[model samples]
Target: MINTFKKDDAQALKGIAIIMMIFHHCFSSTELYEKYTISFFPFKENIIVNIAVICKICVALFAFISGYGLIISYEKKKATASRWALSRYIKTFSGFWIIYILLAFVNIIFRSRFLKVYFGHGIWIGIASVFLDFAGFAKLFGTDTLLVTWWYMSAAVVYILLVPLLYKELKDKTWIILIFSMFFLRVILSHTDAGSFTGSNSIYAFIPVFISGSIFATTLFFSGGY
Candidate 1:
């Protein structure tokens, strides 16, 4: 029997992940309840908070989908790694830069305190950080920027660039790659400070979840079934 994730299957998974993300952002923190009342199940705040916390798996879901989709695309396209990576980056950056630039321009026009407060030190330092933010390297460089969620930007770029190389090297050995990714993630989490959400945004931290997706793609496409 053939088992595979069809296009709609992937899209449905993504929709579920998005809904989970919304729940996580809405109720994961008890502080949110302090600011806004919960009309539904108002007395079950603890249950809601716990459920929301578990919903954090949305990040892993997204990474897995990205890996699966990219690998499937690569398998179909047979494009060179550099070309594929460049195309993916261009697609990602096009949308990213539009929002990044719009926000920056708005902040500048309004003299919003975000830039001054986050991008610190002298004027030149602040300017350099802004450029880094444009490239999604500000968080990696430890230079604070406006958006905490933008850490995913750098993480996404890293995944796109790495996926082609990973597919090339491990296409035939998907299980090995999956095992290695898990081992690497454990080592990083156990040995370093990259366990927290902020610290976990490092480029290599979420490779396990991504590679799990790749493994699924390999099973479905390259190996021709499970």
Candidate 2:
């Protein structure tokens, strides 16, 4: 048969990991784990979860690349680390906010008649969220931003503070620092008890991904960010 698949190790690993992930998700745990000893059931002893978690570990592969990429990006472009970091922050946040605002504007302008008639409830709720984000008083008002992804802006701000630390004397120890930072943050954030809807987990979920990403970065074994 003609070659139909990517031959790269990294590519192969990613595909296999994803298949393993899907396999664990699709099959009942007892059937897969009791027999194949592989599935993702979300417990330490669960063979399926183990298999799935292994595949989920791909992010570590990108940790090193992120460190290296950031350094290269700052240096080659002749931009100060501060400027580079700020630019990235603005780009990420403003991009998301802009989209939210634009959509909300259209929705509101149309909401009285056509928008409500045409668009569904979820979309209208989204417009409301955007209006809340712009207000900047959402928390006090017991509201939230128009889009859930806006929370990432807050997270990105945290990264901005950490990056210069990464850019300075701490650069070479990127992997180690990333691990520790993630662990500490995971511990602290876990206490907040955020919900599943946010995809922002407590320590139980996040530390694993960060550690996995850090491992992949330092080892140069895989290439994924999160």
Candidate 3:
């Protein structure tokens, strides 16, 4: 009968998401099948690919957990919302940038095919592309990301920037906020080149699920559901 989402629940959801991510990345595409040494399934390859495709929900799971955990933690912290968000922004990007810089270094040093493919023609354009990727705006601005998986970075930035700004408004009006997020997501999908599944790098595409998590947390904490 306990419906409360405790910190342990959040961590458990995260663990599940991570496992799904690994499965999705490992078997999602047939092109990469050659990279793996073993395939236990003797049936059609599409079966595994289909299962992997379904595992793409991992992104939504992670987003939900992020929204839920952020609201829960924010409610307990003594710092102002903006300050808390700033600290989170710094922490997230600092960790990301370390790996980003290292990857960029290796790419440039080796003149990897990634640079050749998405560098966007000229030197200035290439630099701009790199800058866009670094700032996590590549997907937002319709620029190419240096790495395919980095599309999530843009979504992460959007989520981090939005949570602090909307958490209070979502406190009592969770349903209203959730509806608005869904409407916003639909609008973005209708008008833009944003896609679903792996190409859903745009925050507008996934904001509803993210806000759903926040609403769940708000309900649990404020409605005596705990």
Best by TM-score: 1
TM-score of predicted structure 3? 0.81
TM-score of each: 0.85, 0.45, 0.81
lDDT of each: 0.75, 0.46, 0.75
Question: What does candidate 1's lDDT look like per residue over 108-213, in tens digits?
Answer: 8998765675556888888888888888887678787777778877778778877877787665665775677677777777666656532355555667778777
Q: How many backbone clashes does candidate 2 have?
A: 15
Candidate 1 has what TM-score? 0.85
Q: Model 2 over residues 84-139: C-alpha lDDT tens digits?
A: 77787666466666775677777668655324432345787656744556533343
- Rate residue 154 of model 2 by lDDT: 46
The whole-model C-alpha lDDT of candidate 3 against the native structure comes to: 0.75
Which residue runs of candidate 2 sit more than 4 Å off their true CA positions? 1-77, 112-143, 194-219, 222-226
- Alpha-carbon deviation at 7 in model 1, angstroms: 2.2
Off by over 4 Å in 3: 1-3, 35-37, 42-44, 114-120, 174-177, 180-199, 221-226
lDDT of 2: 0.46
Candidate with more favorable, higher TM-score: 1 or 2:
1
